[model samples]
Structures are given as structure tokens and as C-alpha cells.
Target chain A: MKNRIVILGVLLALGFSAQAQKYFTRDARVQFNSDTPVEKIEAVNKSGTSVLDTQTGRMDWKVLIKNFLFEKALMQEHFNENYMESTKYPNATFKGSITNLQDVNFAKDGTYKVTAKGAMTIHGVEQEITVPGTLTVGGGAVKVKADFVVKPADYKIDIPGVVRDNIAKEIAVTIDASLKPMGK
Target chain B: MLKKIVLFLAVAGVIGAGIGYYMFNKKVPSMASEKSEVTIEAAQLYQEFEADEAAASAKYVGKIVAVSGTVLEASALEDGTPKVLLDTGSDFGVSCEFDPNTKHAKTTFTPGEKLTLKGECAGINLDVQLARCVVVQ
Candidate 1:
């Protein structure tokens, strides 16, 4: 009887602790730019969702590909129909953990450098990447910012030779998201 | 023969100039300028997306839609763009992001006021999000 009671108590404590460790946000902003000598293309998607567990340093992020908005309608159509093939692959997701979690003080208000290593899947292709970012904790909120470069060839996206000179070989991506407590 | 060649070159130059002007100076289309593919209520829209996300995406993704709902929340984005979220009677709702240059002068939406908007559907995440939305009524 004593062992049974101890097990129940431990399970209850684990549930509460697990709930406290999660931080999430629904409106994370993700932007990307492809700049070459001939053309400059840009898009922004603000419907990103992300969740982070402070206890385990596990993070997950998802953004819908069709949500990216371009200035020109033609570019937007081309991005969805030709480049990303949103009908086939509607979302891009990242699953990884913070490698430098020990340096981050979740209870304090400060900025810490973080390294995230994980697989980022875009256009049905997955690539393992490690990128450095910054985490800012203030006012009971957490802000994350990161910049990385991706090659279209890595994602099986072929650029036609006709527009090869207009598009860059490496596309620069930027992410900025502010996260608040979950279930608030 | 030389005169004919010069005439042909002049005609080609005129056509090239016209094409260049249209390509570089085309204006971005406004949300009100296009027809919506679907018209749905806020609750129903969210329900469809939440029920079967893949089917909902196939039906509404990359299409213009008109949604009518009550305003649950309104806020300015990081870049001062206005965003209005419609109530769906659940945790998830419809989020409408307006264009930066859209006119919202002297406009204030009290919570629970019914409003209609049109925009391009961008699939769903936590919400059925729409971009470049314009107020229809």
C-alpha cells in the first residue's frame, strides 16, 4: 500500500512539473530573402507556431508554406505552385533541442546565445542543420531570433536556367518569434 | 534592303519597350479587386480546418475567401500592421492580417461586433489565417 501511494504521488508531481515547463506561441514571424544581382525576392509568413520545453530544452516549430506573402502576386503564385508545391507539402517543420540549455536561465531576464541542431524539412526534403541563435527572456516572455542560409538544390528544388541568374544559389532565411506561457 | 531592316528593328524596339514597362511597373492587385472562391462563417471555417486539416487545405488553400464573424481581438503587429481575430467558439479561430497600406482610419471594433472581410486563405496553423485582408463591410 505504501508503494502504491508513493507511485501516485510521483505521477501527480510529474504532471504538474511537465505542464509548467512548456512555453508556446502561435504567431511567430518567419521571413526569407533570395537576392541576386538581377532580382531581389522576399516573403514573410507570420502564422508560425512553436513550442519549447524549458526543462528538457526540446523545441518544435511549424509554419505553413502557403502563408508566405510576397509583394507581387505572380511571385506568390509561382512560390506556391512552382517552387514550394504547397499542394504536396503544405508545411515545414523543425524538431530539435537547445544544445546550450545549461547557459540559459529561464527564471532570469537576460539574453543568452543558443545553438539548435535539428532536422528542418522543407518541400518534402529534410536536412540536418545546426544554427546559432539568440534567446531573450524578459517581461515573462521569451524571444527567439535566428538567421540561416539554405540551398534550393538541397531541398530538390530545381531552378530553371532561364531564371537562374535572377535567383540566388543560397537563400537567406530569418526567424523572429516571441513566445508566451501556454494555457494562459 | 537596308530600309526594310531598319523598319523591322524599330518595330522590335517598340514591342520590347512596351513589355519592359509592363513587367517592371505592374501594380500589385488589391484584395477587393479579386473574387472570393468561398464564403463561410468564422465558426464553420475553423471547424472545417480542425475537423480534417488535409481536406480543408485542399479545398481552401491558395484561394480567396470571404469570412463573416465577430471580432474577438484586434492588435497591431510588430510592423504596425493591423490584425483582427474572429471568434470560433474554441481555442482556435480565424486570424485576419490586413495589408500595411490598408486604410483603417477612425475604425475601432468593439468585441463581439460582427464584421465581414475578404482575403487570400493561407491554410491553417493554430488558426485559419488569412493574409492581405480587406474589410468588406
Candidate 2:
């Protein structure tokens, strides 16, 4: 009977580990807006990924810079060649823990305000940032929405004097992500 | 005095015309097609690669470019070709395929030398998502 109990315990442990709530999205959309009277430009990175660990309240995200597309082709080229230097610095990432993780109940359908504090790395510079976001959890799916600002000089991105007025010193970034259960 | 004034005005007009001609006819460096290609530092290039691999690779395609980064991994091709993997210090890294015939390919770069490579942007692998590269230098 003891051996059978031990076997049952092992199976229960495996089942709990398998059911650990982890969510991910490969198609997370991150957009950056730089508005100036000279040029109102918006760029979107369509191929970003965000991973959410419910058990630990840890969140990880990565986005490719080259994928960020602009409406004008010339502007796109200028962005890669001149501004972001896509060939030189290609990705941005965030790794942080959700401060209000316990407040979110993934099993229930509801909207919860979440505060995530983590290090955001961009243009080869890493900065610690706290971002507040709204998470919608329902039907085995999760959606995240957040907006924040980052300074260009902080990342060592030098805007040339000629077009410095056109690009803002602080860029506004918005994130809208949909995540699914890892195995699913 | 009227004649002198007319002469002065004509000379001024001639000088103005000459200056205009110089301005229009003299070679002004064209920002486009000038091939003012600058070798991007390896660390910077890697950062760009990490941001957007496909878009970054597409932007540099068919251009004379130079990039520097650390060597991540290097290996030999089945056809006796040598390949080098470079980490641009960014999330996006690239594998450079060198022509086996080149002497420099035999021995020029080592891992973590912050190598600056000059090459024609060959294009990228959209399928496997590898940084498609060919060595020019």
C-alpha cells in the first residue's frame, strides 16, 4: 500500500507540473510612434514574442528591430541605415516579473491591471523600467496591452542634427499581445 | 554715370550667372548612389540584427557593406567550405559563408576578435530565417 501511495504521489506531481500555467505569443505586436510636425511616423514590429509564467509571475519578451516596418520605403531604409542601424543592433528584449500576478486569476474571465517591473534592453543598452498593463484572461487565452516611453540617447542612438527635430527624443512604445497555452 | 551703372549691372549679372552655372554644373556629392558605405561596427550591427533579422538583412542586400562582431561559431561545409558565425553583440547574429578559394578564408579571423567584414549583401534565408550572407572581403 505504501508503494502504491508513492506511485500515486509521483503521478500527481507530474500532472501538476504539466498543468503549470505558462502562456506565449509569437505574434505580439509592438509599435513605436515618433510624432513631429515635419513627419508623423509609426513603426511596428509584428514578430515579437511574449512569454508569461503564471506560477512565478515572470514575463519574458523579445522583438526584432528589422521587422519594424514603416509606410514609406525611403523612410524604412533611412530607419535601418541611419537611425536604428538595423544591421548593427537587431533586437530588443524585456525580462521581468509581474508585481500583481496573484491578483490575476487566469481560470476566470476578467480584466486585471498588472504592474510589471523588469529590465528592457534596446539598441544594446539595458535599462530597468516599470510598466503597467492590462491583461485580459479568458477561454484559455491571454492578451496584454501596455504603453511606455523610451529615450533615444539612453540607448546611444544619436539623431543627426539635420533631422533631429523630426524624431522625438523620447519614443512612445505600445504593446498589444495575445498569448496561448504553451502546449496548445 | 548711366553707362557706368549699366556696365556694373551687366558685370554683376554675368558674375551671378557664372556662380549659378558653377552651382548647377559642378559635381555635388549625391547622397544616393555615392556608395558612401561605412563599415558598421560589429557590436552595433549585431544589435540591429537582433531587433529585426529579416528586415535588417533585406535592407543591406546588394550593397557593399562592412560589419564587425564576435565570432559565435565556425564550421566547415561539406564542399570543403569554411563558415563563420558572428555574434553582432545583438540578439540577431549572422553566419558568413566564405569562398573556399580565398586565401584569407584559410586564416584571417578568429572567435571574439570583433571582426569587421566587407561583403556584398547577398540576401537572407526567409524560410529557415538564417542571415543569408556571402563574403566579399
- Among the numbered candidates, top DockQ falls to 1
Give a tens-digit lDDT track for model 2, residues B1-137. 99999999999999999987665344312222224254775555555545686675666644556666667656554334455666754434554554322345344456666555554443332111122234433
TM-score of 1: 0.89
**Residue lDDT tens for model 1, B1-137:** 99999999999999999987787546457776778889999999999999999999888887899999999988766876777899999987899888653565524567788989888888887889898788886
Which of the CAPRI classes, incorrect, acceptable, medium or high, describes model 1? Answer: medium
| Candidate 2 CAPRI-style tier | incorrect
Each candidate's interface RMSD (Å, one decimal) is: 2.2, 11.9
- Top-TM-score candidate index: 1
| Models, CA RMSD each | 3.7, 13.9
True contacts kept of 1: 0.53
10 residues in a row with least lDDT, candidate 1 chain A: A69-78
In candidate 2, which residue ranges exceed 4 Å CA deviation? Answer: A1-19, B1-137
lDDT of 1 by residue, A122-183 (tens): 99999999989999999999999999998999999878888889789999999999988887
- Cα displacement (Å) at residue A102, model 1: 1.1
The collision pairs in model 1 are: none
